[model samples]
Target: MILDAISSAAGTSSAAKDRAGIADNFDTFLQILTTQLKNQNPLEPLDTNEFTAQLVQFSQVEQQIKQNENLEAITQLAAATAATNAVSFVGKRVSVSTTQSELTNGTANWQYSAAKDADAAKFTIRDSAGKVVWTGERDISKGDNNFTWDGRDAGGLKLTDGNYTLSVSAKDADGETVTVGIAAEAIIDGVDFSGEEPLLLAGDTTIPMSSVKRIHNQ
Candidate 1:
């Protein structure tokens, strides 16, 4: 994806090669025109106007190829800048809009916001296998609410430490669905450059740079 993004920004994969081929062909054309002029009868010289126009056409093509090269350079520089900026995020904590969370040290935390006052909010915790291991209700307010789970299942039995997901469903007093947004916080362990954009490695979860809502100090 990263390569695709870069290539898309620069134009095409064969852009440089195409430009080189165009330059070589133009040089050969110029040589052929020069030879034809030298061999033409001086009594009726080859039409200079036609050759002049051909030269202009070749110049235009060369200019366009140069412009494309400049654009490709700019695109490469921008990608490098993004990667450099992403390096600073390492070791810092960030809040990302994601459903997955890591259960470390026997706990996991998340923050959710309610659009309106919800009479009731149900929280469901699912393992990586998509099995609902825990389900409970949380007393939520109209705005922001924080939730914490102690790595325990519905039966109060401790679960193994790993990655899990939290989902919240809320309803207003009218029983209509209440819009909710969920977010998870984690420390940026590293940056993954294997994608179109840098991915923040937060424990076992990979969060895209665009998904980060906020960054916090460690």
Candidate 2:
């Protein structure tokens, strides 16, 4: 019965549930052992070795459950600390490694770095619905370059303010594809903890902590 409880506790969905089940089962085992020891016949006494082993098993399971609970508390504490630290990023400018950017006040910006000097470079802007809204050519550079969009389509019509994605393709002098890394910069307006981890609210998009490259002065 104790072994079955241990197995069930191991497969429980949450640490709290597992701890509760383990404690309950451990108590029940102790109660049963106590009762047996109290009512055992003098001629056919409960074997000391067997009861001792059962007590040892209960102790081991209890220790394991306690360790699990401690570790869970530590993890929760770490997550809370991270979320608290993220709050400081609000109102600060942050650069994140992502292809998506939000257009606000008629402008959006992105940063890109080319692996090598490119002979030709093409930039494409796509709306949130994955529709290409604008296309333009950019000057090839060896390293980092910044691109700005004025929230206009290819035909010079203004588009509504929303999230957009920018992609760049470049070819080297020998016609080989040049690798490019894309990023965006924005001010953190708020912190979001509704997800598995905390996210920085940057304009209309949420930036994960892993994606953040740098934080800058506002």
Best by lDDT: 2
lDDT per residue for candidate 1 within 12-131, as digits (tens), equals 435566666656556666676778778989898887777677677767867888898899899999999889878888998888898888898899999888899887689999999999
Query: What are the lDDT figures for the candidates, one per model?
Result: 0.82, 0.85
Provide the lDDT at 72 for model 2. Answer: 90
TM-score of each candidate? 0.85, 0.83
Measured by TM-score, the strongest candidate is: 1
- As a whole number from 0 to 100, the lDDT of residue 65 in candidate 2 is 73
* CA-only RMSD, every prediction: 7.2, 3.4
